[model samples]
Target: MAVSDECKIKFRELKAKRSYRFIVFKIDQQQIVVETLGGPNQSYDDFTSSLPSNECRYAVYDFEFITAENCQKSKIFFIAWSPEISKVRMKMVYASSKDSFKRELDGIQFELQATDPSEMSLDIVKGRAI
Candidate 1:
């Protein structure tokens, strides 16, 4: 599937920030890769300061891509943090097909995992209930 303009814009914003992580899911392989993108998250000041270089300070993010031809888009959800803030903020973004934004939106919703104190989380994409 092609990456929508909206998705490109988000990537540009992330690129400009110069720090973020991406969790890209490859459908063929049925796996995801959580890696650093153009830059590191700019929030880890403590660790950043202690690092050998400035690149050490940045936000860590994970992205999941839905690449089934049957599915034209994917829902992206992750935690965003910054030194200016006290708590981690969870955000949701969507990558929709140019002609099927509505369909994609209908298939997506968020599931918050606040009940688990050990690992509070948010999932924007819930393809299956299981």
Candidate 2:
């Protein structure tokens, strides 16, 4: 699917203004890492521990993460968008697998960020910022 112009613009703006951080964890006895960018500062500050091992398929080495008290209350997912195929693929899983947490990853999303500003484009952008 083609990203909206507004989304593209917002994505660009985020690319220019946001700072990204990564977190490694495991679920179901599986190891996965999440790399998140933007959102509130607390998103990175409120994490208690790493996620458990689960099925993750986003990046090869690193993922995305944010530290927020509110976000901690749910199972977060890392999905990648493929402009060539017009679809979003779930690559990494970030969820609070603890029964006490009882939080479902709602509204959790991602976009690919380009290291080079010139490479930022729908055709080039893969996943949300991370």
| Number of backbone-clashing residue pairs for each candidate, in the order shown | 8, 31
- Total backbone clashes of model 1? 8
CA-lDDT, candidates in order: 0.28, 0.28
Q: Provide TM-scores for the models.
A: 0.22, 0.22
| Regions more than 4 Å wrong, model 1 | 1-10, 13-35, 38-69, 81-130
Model 2 collision count:
31
lDDT (tens digit, per residue) of candidate 2 on 10-116: 33333343332222222323432233223434333232112212232222112233435433222223322112222123231222222211122223343332223
Lowest lDDT block of 10, candidate 1: 51-60
* Superposition TM-score, candidate 1 onto the true structure: 0.22
On TM-score, the leading prediction is 2
Give one digit per residue, the lDDT tens place, for model 1 in 1-130.
3334443444445434423433221111221222234334432233223322211111223233455555443332332222222222211122222123223222223322221222322222233212
**What is residue 111's positional error in candidate 2, in angstroms?**
8.9
Model 1 deviation from the true structure expressed as Cα RMSD, one decimal place: 14.4
Candidate 2 residues lying further than 4 Å off, grouped into runs, are: 19-38, 42-78, 81-130
